[model samples]
Target chain A: MTDTLLEIDNLSVDYETGRGDLQALRDITFNVNKGEIVGIVGESGCGKSTLISSILRLTAPNTRFREGEIRFKGQDLLQVSERHMRDLRGADISIVFQDPMQTHNPVLTIGQQMLDIQHRSKQSKADKRAHATKMLGAVGIPDPEARLKQYPHEFSGGMRQRIAIAMALMSEPDLLIADEPTTALDATLEVQIIERLQELQREFHCAILFISHHLGVIAELCDRVVVMYAGAVVESGDVREIFHDPKHPYTRRLIECDPGHLKERARVLPTIPGEVPDLANLPGGCIFRDRCDQALARCATEVPPLDQLKEGHHAACWLNHEEATS
Target chain B: MSLLNVVDLNTSYGAVNVLAGVSFSVEPGETYALVGESGSGKTTVIRAIAGLAPAQEGSVTFEGQEIRGAPEKVMRPLRKDMAMMFQDPVGSLSPRLTIRSLITEPYRIQGMKDRDLDTEAKRLLEMVNLPTHFADRYPYQLSGGQARRVGVARALALEPKLILADEPTAGLDVSVQGELLNLLNDLRERLGLAMVIITHNLSVVRHVADRMGILYLGRLVEEGTTETIFNEPRHPYTRCLLSANPEPDPDARLDRIALKGEPPSLLMRPSGCEFRERCPFSKEICTQTPEWEVNGGHGLRCLAPLS
Candidate 1:
């Protein structure tokens, strides 16, 4: 899409092990439009984490990207220098990690963390407290003035998450990536935080890359979704279309698997026969061939291209798309 | 007869009262939900009933016998009648012990005689839909769903009349969560067990709980049937609780009620109506404790109850 905020082409990541080179992600391609929430969803160990890490260059020395282009806001992130990337990390692009308990410094006060974010954006330490309070209040932290003095341990799980979100937004990045930010919270608070985050996203006019294992969450926050499996993009489409009439077998299984999503499917839940295939040593041809109920002989020997079905929607399956053309 | 009856339950931590003037009853095959946010003291009431923590006031009657603060030995027999599942599966199940040994720990502690611990453990595992060979593996060897199954097996080992599950499906993926919830519902029906599920999930209560109770700070603000709570929440706190939860489906848009400010500490709780400070519809009587009102069997703790 010409209006795309991000266009990842042939992205691949590798993890070096004693046994051999572990292929964590293989030739993944996807895009997120401006102001659209695009979800990257997969079960744990399906390389969801690796994909996020690669985007931020947070991968350890043991991991390496073989080939890909990460074009964000018309700039190549992979080719950017450390100094340039550091400036972009919080100011131009930001991330909210899964666990605030670990992401937040336990001993430091919420004020200190907020100040740190402001400091990164070239604000004075003395003037950061007020800015921090304003940011915290914006995130819906009640009595942000008094709360700034309290340490992370003193805050409840939900409150800590709010503070963490405040930190992510302090710099007001254009692209905000949240990976399972509500996983550790109670359901009551989980819903509140997500709602608040959605409001904030709209108010800030920023694109969100929401990552989670639950398709239910993607159904909630994402405008578009990119289904990942065994280090490949299985399907990509508008959230409503993909959810209502999923074509790919993996996408169909995922929609049928979620109890909450079954409101639409409205039948007996169909679980995928086996667990996510091991990414390190993948078989030739389509990675989903072994598990697909409709797998043909050609699917086992030749890799299927991510073919277009309609405007801004694609699926990598050997299905007839001419009939589905809109 | 009601399997469990708690009346005017007033529990405390040191001098701080956490549960005040609470009353509820669980029928032989009913599921009761204790729903609330953090610091709402839902867990405290369960802990008090389990005797992990003591209730400073009120009575807990099991099988029509009241035991306010009995000695551990006097309460020993009742322990067999109740079992609790913790939120953290790893912490609840011993990392050092195999799944087989974990399930039998309750029986071992009570010093039961002529019990085939291994065989019973394996059967319990199967009951929870765990693989038979998983009995040999420790907690670390299992996946999140497997560990949850082990926890369920351990909780079911003694065939307790009542089960207190604290956030049973927290930290699990969606598919696994559905399986675990369905499994629990199936078990409850087959065993005719009474379950008091403590969670903040409104959707969870909708599917599993027959009745609902809403707690705020340290008080039971509302109590009624699931349909009553969802359809006509009388208390402002309960309404806010429901409205706060965003529907996972994007097609549905919910105008959430923003509950600003932290919950007042129990050490020095607000004068009256713990939720008054953040309540959207607080009235003059909100400053004073509202009298309980019953309409169509639904009781509410709000000055201006929803009609």
Candidate 2:
């Protein structure tokens, strides 16, 4: 088996706007190895969602694929036909969205929904129910057997999210993409969900692409962390290494701004001045230049490439490039 | 006298009893954080204080004067001294109204036409670190952070002595959230204004709060200084909530406590302790309303002793 499970190379996508095409994902390149948990961290409008959609070919009608290849299990997913993609979606690749309520059918019983999705499994109806109950129990849902009869409204928000996770894993897909699954949950529930996800990952051995803006969740669950700013990946490295010694200025600012790690009652939290740049009228050179604290004169004219800072660590910044050249 | 004191505040919506004998007080120039999960009645406590949600039983004394069950005319004057920032900025600000009009609406409501509203509006915008040009734009033209800043500006129109902000940083980016939090902290220090911040995030509590009260099933389960709550929590729920908050530092080892599920609905709320169903350390005594164990400034309502 190949070590890499999913590979996204130079993938660029744009959305059709009134004036012209607005670039959402620009030359984004990354890899998820077999059974590895990769985290994508970025602010809103940073193209994290676009990147996820690109993997499943679920981009909007206005979305235009400008460049790059998305290879899943050595086969280019972008080149696959619609029929083939459909088979691959839930069977080989599954996703858990941020809002579980939207994903679930409010009127249907949990068993009915679970059984409907398992038609492709070719298992007996009774067998499917057994598997569903087991998966739900694995996700820390109590009374899984009795819960199968309950409607979506019967469960609480956190429990609904857990049921969603259970449904996502019922197929035992090779790759799982969770887009801010715990963002809606409380802090305590967030911890429970992340820990449960970690435990499930170990048991299932599925490659996970976990996307979140919460740094603490990323730090706790991810083996590798990818930091995105604007529409591009600003930095990527091991979770601990990146958290301890962030290479990119944007990554540094993102980490420093989090109040989760503050040891004392902070008098004033350090803030990044200015607003996120308009994606339609993006600045030249680095996308993060306008809000970046360490932008140089050359940053206005030259776009920085993802330069290697260390083994398995890379940062896309002019400062890093200059340091390497010097 | 305390700036705001809520004693045995009990509120209910028709058949559902939301808050059951909730009590807390905020001193002058203090930042009090009320935190809880969804359906814990954190927002209800704030709404109760603002007179939006009237308490069925209890007394809310502001500056040593009883405001609960007060007449509309009596409450009208007090509105000028207290302002509230809603959780959803987009919903809080009217889409048709320009930023300037929104900020000055409070002054216009109080029938103060003599004041220089135009200048006051500009100063309010600047105080929230929003650009002067944004004053001309409608609420829809602004982003989430910008709209929140406008909400803060609107909340400060009457120069309120006590500010009640409900999740001021919700749905904002990391940097923007930090900036808004710092702005609130700075404003509190500059104006010596007391605040009651209602939120679900413990991180925000750690940053700006002086004291914090944890609510469960509309009851304040624990209350103490932020330092004491984080370092040495006596309540099982408080300890679980603190440990459940994932520390950003990867090196820190966390011992997480797994609760059964979310708080039961208000309709199906357990008799004694609202948290009895979900508390891992719950015992038979938890079925009865636990007595408040007070020590120094820290206090918790629980049957189980801290391990």
Candidate 3:
């Protein structure tokens, strides 16, 4: 039997806006297995960030978890105390944000910040410093000892991002939430970061919930993919299956829209012909029906349940559901 | 004659030399792309060409007229034949202005008071496939894609022969980015406008650019037709960049030529090849600078080019 690291079940989230309550995430469900990289792919306003925030129990003041549970190690994280959550944060889970320029304290040296993250550990100062140096070296930083003494601003953009990843993995957490960690880097540097992450993940034996809008990066790194649209999970399957044979119309269109998939130079690239619906006043059907090309008439009145099409593959679309049922 | 020709363009900010003798030429109705990593002076090349950033030395000829060091009075009339689209979608637009005033502000700036702005605004919006009613909305009311369309509309207000676009498809969804690319391609063909696009996205360069130049440390490492460069890249840096770009297909080969270390700082550039530090094919001969060699239509500055 496969070991499940984290299970998010039927989670729903809403934001209190001036006009009305904005439903950011609706009936979201996914699971990360031990030592597996799962990617969450979606466009802006599709609640990718909101899903990350909800898992860390770090929602904004004007937000509320409408329903569902985030179970980690068989215990519901939503039912945990603030103190318990705080203890579990760095020790059990950690995050690397998009912009490394803002990830660290400007005044603090890299060595100081690295040691500070390991404050929960009872190890001696010398041991922690040694660990920090090794971690920096693992991320391919040159002269780890001298580099640790320097400030974050002294590092280049690629180096800063590498250092950020080093700091996040210092505790050797079970799950690492990389929220567009390589998005800010250049193409060459992005490749380096992805390779380093792959190496580091294998060494640390930690699961990764990689979230990004770039389909190429997702395809490169993720083993399984969870495609989100309009604050809902439209498709979740093996990376190969999702890219090769996408069942949901939204997933198919998304893959087709990527410029990397274009074999020849065409005058007009295919595009979805509509905008994302307003979250405050959602339509009474599939969240993606407005932009979905293969949307059926039934899709306008009822939301299709996530149906199992094949082993370890699921898609939420009326067309897929009919195909599976038939 | 070429539509625009920039020969040995050199731009420097203080002691740091940003663009070091970069040169390229664009024919009328041709689309050329400047591709590079950040700090590689892709934007600065266009800025230098537009005279927004002063060039230390170079010859920029537009329509057979010398514009390199032309005075403001002489350059003022040239502005009507050239337009620029800034990188940011919403940030580039004036926040207080309505869509109507924003797109037609070019006419006002040029002191062309004889034309009716409302009709011009409607025409520009229709050209960009946006509803004419959008002219009444403010910049804040539009989405990223819509704001980009407005930027395009503003750039096309003067009906320029040449357009300089910087990261036109950035900060949009895949579908939205495709829409913008299609719009740009359609407009370029319909207007027969020559364009110089600056972006790091190789996919975008492949889609729209007829020819492309790969820049490293403010110098063109390689220049050739986009099809040739993608198929048979000569420079190690160009090959690395092409291989590094993550292809969306899962079945595509993942044999990435992982570049080592970060790009060296401009303040203390490495001797000889600037890309040698990260290049996997660096040899002893790479210590000395390679000549910019051109054969047929392809050119590259490399001591040991890929066969």
The top-ranked prediction according to TM-score is 3
- Lowest summed lDDT across 10 adjacent residues in model 3 chain A is found at A182-191
Candidate 3: which pairs clash? none
CA displacement after TM-score superposition, residue A55 of candidate 3 (Å): 1.1
Q: How does model 3 score on DockQ?
A: 0.79
What tens digits encode model 1's per-residue C-alpha lDDT throughout B1-307? 7888998889876777888877888998789999988778888888777778778888888888776687888778787878899888888887899888898888887788679987888789889877788878889988877788888888888888889888887767656676788788778878888899987766667778889898887778899998888888888888888876645465767667767666777788887777788887878887887766677878888887767
**On a 0 to 1 TM-score scale, where does candidate 2 land against the true structure?**
0.94
| Whole-structure CA lDDT of model 2 | 0.89
CAPRI level of candidate 2 = medium
lDDT of 3 by residue, A47-84 (tens): 99999988899999999899999998878999999999
Interface RMSD of 1: 4.1
Docking class of 1: acceptable
Tell me how candidate 3 scores on lDDT: 0.91
Best by lDDT: 3
**Best-fitting candidate, measured by DockQ?**
3
Q: In model 3, where do residues sit more than 4 Å from their true spots?
A: B69-71
- Per-residue lDDT tens digits of candidate 3, residues B1-307? 9999999999888989999999999999999999988889999999888878899898999999989878888888888888999999899988999999999999998999998999999999999889999999999999888999999999999989999998887767889889888888888888899999987778888999999999999999999999999999999999989988898987898777877777888889899998888899998899998889999999999998998
Query: If the candidates were sorted by their TM-score against the true structure, best first, what order would they fall in?
Result: 3, 2, 1
